[model samples]
Target: MRDTSTSEIENLIALMAKLPGLGPRSARRAVLHLIRKRALLLTPLADSITEVAATARECLNCGNIGTNDICPICEDNERANGELCVVEDVSDLWAMERAGVFKGRYHVLGGTLSALDAVGPDDLRIPRLLDRVPAEAVTEVILALNATIDGQTTAHYIADQLSGQVRLTSLAQGVPIGGELDYLDEGTISAALRARKEI
Candidate 1:
């Protein structure tokens, strides 16, 4: 059977496939769906994407993506509680914000320390974080990095750098709230045991 998809449609599918968690098959299905709902979905989505592409920029203070120089979180004076949460990426910062628990400001590292990838402190926003500590009068820093080896390494590097300056803490690692012990890996079990708190 001769190929029937136009070059433009194929290009759109290819672009969509490049997005995280999307494969060629999924992108194809999504493209078909969008085509069917052109008036309701495709045109609006295209306009939104174009707008965001034109206006989106990284926050100068914390590296969060926003339309302005500084993000709303950074601009909010109420969030300046002298407690800074350091995360590996804007996505992690957003996750913390969704929880609505931490009222302090954030510092996005952009990425973790990866020796394998030759990503060092200078490559990330470590210098900016260090600057923010004293400039913002931060009293505590919560390291909310992932449990990956690189993330832990980055957390340690930041901790060492900020030692004797402020209180430092890290997110506890363990089995999830509803995770079954039998289904968990040994590493998770060990971490859970080590991070156990008084009931």
Candidate 2:
């Protein structure tokens, strides 16, 4: 490693550089900025990161990230609308929530089925989803997975498994091919959710 005057600050920058979308250059700049605003930004940010690292956990029922075993949406009785929207990741679930179109519950799959990655239905929360369907008294299952090949494959697998049990639907045309839900705007997500078609 390169020698630095402040090894602790250098270590912090090195760690930050490993975060998604942030490179070494950006991490250095961020570290300098944080140093400049130590009182207003750095201290609070460090505290927040520590708090989250200590408390962050996946919801046992739906896989949503929160501080509790069950997520807020899963715990809320008002969200038990007999509908479940399945997404490939937590970010997609958050995006859907941002849209505020579906007042129902959500199930995060963690990732899509990928033969290349050796991921299968059992690898995901597919079995948990099935168990929750009857347990939660769900009437519909909306596949809000991405438009990628793996996403479609996973959707079909779920559809087949829950064939006659509940109404299966998917997001409408607004979601472009290969577009991840996290990148979509709130309006686009809302429109797609509103216009979801039976699959």
Candidate 3:
């Protein structure tokens, strides 16, 4: 016969394993740690996760995830620097925010255009980004996309659309081959942003 409490802990481990970068071993270790430090970590983490699950939403204008229709970044008037940084997803946007380099606005594109996957301009937030350019008085569009082929293809397509509309640029060297922006360190991201080259 199975112990119900043990099964419950195993279920928690299974759920944690589904998260990115966590394997069965790591999940088991994490679950043990959480159980041991329930008051210090597990309880607060569970509460926070519940709160985010209930309140997390996407910003209508930029596709940024937040607790409101308009994210705090979008609502901040000072971030209207006429420079919009375009990223592949909310994770990349958060990475940029963590770096704390660019003081401009952001436009989360959701994901890159993938021909093989049948993803197109309409699939992402490209159209909304286009609308934002002129409406927000944007003078520059920084393609802070990943170093992957799909990311570059999407960036080029966006650059073509906004060629005459605004200045176009992409992160310079330092980003490794096929690297996702979400995995890069803060200093690396800051360097890339500062050394950005026109695309």
Candidate 4:
């Protein structure tokens, strides 16, 4: 980052370092690799980034990132199956889609209710979700928030708000597939037992 490195290269490294999971050392290595493969990787990557920067926008309905006001999932009328899946973020929604399950529509809450962060229901898309329920004639709501403390608190708050309005359900939490009992934590073991089903 001194006499050997140009300011532009240093700047690129700095920007890359700011990305999640990429520290300064990793960013430096990545930048060096990109420079070596400029024609093959850097130019194409830069072009794609520029295109996405100009067109990427959040879906107004579900907070999913897309190039339009309404994301493709929200625009799909066939997805309206009287079932709504509530998730904490766009990443969670994408993860669900990657699994190729859950054919119903989705509602992203943006974030969880957190006392420490002072994030309230209004701060997220909670009100939007509330409006979507009656407006969309939703019969069942599936809470797919993470299992963190704040996530559970947010889920409970949503459940209370929508109580008696529709059939409410939550994603079952427990030990993961192929997990060993010795490696499993106490809470995970307890949840797995509680959520056990008949064979």
Question: Candidate 4, TM-score vs. the true structure?
Answer: 0.95
- Each candidate's lDDT (Cα)? 0.94, 0.94, 0.94, 0.94
Q: Provide the global lDDT of candidate 4 against the true structure.
A: 0.94
What is the per-residue lDDT of model 1 for residues 46-163, given as tens digits with 9 covering 90 to 100? 9999999999999999999999999998999999999999999988998998999999999999999998999989999999999999999999999999988999999999999999
Give candidate 4's error at residue 35 in angstroms: 1.1
- In candidate 3, how many clashes are counted? 0
TM values, all candidates: 0.93, 0.86, 0.83, 0.95
Model 2 TM-score on a 0 to 1 scale: 0.86
Weakest 10 consecutive residues, lDDT, candidate 2? 1-10
For residues 133-156, what per-residue lDDT tens digits would candidate 3 score against the true structure?
Answer: 999999999999997889989999
Per-residue lDDT of candidate 4, residues 59-175 (tens digit): 998899999999998899999899999999999999999998899999999999999999999999999999999999999999999989999999999999999999999988888
TM accuracy, model 3: 0.83
- Using TM-score, give the best candidate's number: 4
Q: Which ten residues in a row have the lowest lDDT in candidate 3?
A: 170-179
- List the candidate numbers ranked by TM-score, top first: 4, 1, 2, 3
